[model samples]
Target: MSKRYIITGAPGTGKSSLLLQLQKEGIHCFSELSRKVIQHQQKLKGNKTPWGDILGFAELIYQKTIEELKSPVNEISFVDRGLADMTAYLTSQSYFIPGYLQHFPYKKYYKNTVFLLPPWKEIYVNDPQRPQTFKEAMQIHEHLIKTYKNLSFNIETLPKTTLTKRKEIILSLI
Candidate 1:
């Protein structure tokens, strides 16, 4: 069976940094779509709502991920943020979760384990697009954990540790 892992956390929790490290280690890891989209939007439209851009970009990423997952690959796949993570973000913002998401059998597509990165204040940085405060990141982190638990997923909350240790923990879970 193809194992699909989700590495998720609030903004500034080193989700992207850790995933980039894993990719360097030759692990099959998907990049964070939100950062890319934010960069694109910043270049295209001076300034815009970060949340709105993230929502649209996340949808595109999900489509691309599903397509990629369709083809067989030797190594286990790790998505920086999964579809459920997007739903949780939108839901927390009081946005209606898209109906199509309910149709996708996510459990069938990915492994049951979800690795959640805890909010790390030391690494939190607010750029032009990602202007979230540390408090907000913590709130989002808690919401993500609750959302995944509500969905009955086996979640492992990872601590703020060295990149190598994080990778080792994730590998053990998969």
Candidate 2:
């Protein structure tokens, strides 16, 4: 079976950077849908939160993730983020998730092994794509880890090290 891995962490923890580096190394990976949607909204509205546009963007992420999971490629695939990340965002922002998702089980779609990068304050930097404060990132990171634990996943925390070392840790775990 094709293994699906989620590379997730607090914002600015190098989730996207590591994924990009892995892709450059010829590893299959998918971009974070939330980042893509956020960028698109920013471009069209000149602001981060384009009021009345988040729901649609969230839905797009949900659909795109499912599509990526069902792709024909039979290689290991790494998702920059995962479905649990979406739920955490909505829940954190006090937005109501659709009823279907409230009862949906995400563990079935992904694998048991989940690689999480801890928040690295030393390298944390806010950018146009990510505007979360350090405290907020920490909260989200804690929430995400709890959420994944609730799903009974085999969680492995990757150290805040060089990209190559992180990749080695993940490879060894899998």
Error of 2 at 22 (Å): 2.0
Q: Between which residue pairs do clashes occur in model 1?
A: none
Query: Candidate 2: worst 10 consecutive residues by lDDT?
Result: 46-55
TM-scores, one per candidate: 0.85, 0.87
Worst 10 residues of 1 by lDDT: 46-55
lDDT values for all models: 0.76, 0.77
Tens digit per residue, CA lDDT, model 1, 63-125: 766776686755577887877776777766777767666566778767788899998888889
Residue 66's lDDT in candidate 2: 72
Best by lDDT: 2
Q: Once all C-alphas are superposed, what RMSD does model 1 give against the true structure?
A: 2.5
Q: State the displacement of the C-alpha of residue 130, model 2, in Å, after optimal TM-score superposition.
A: 0.6
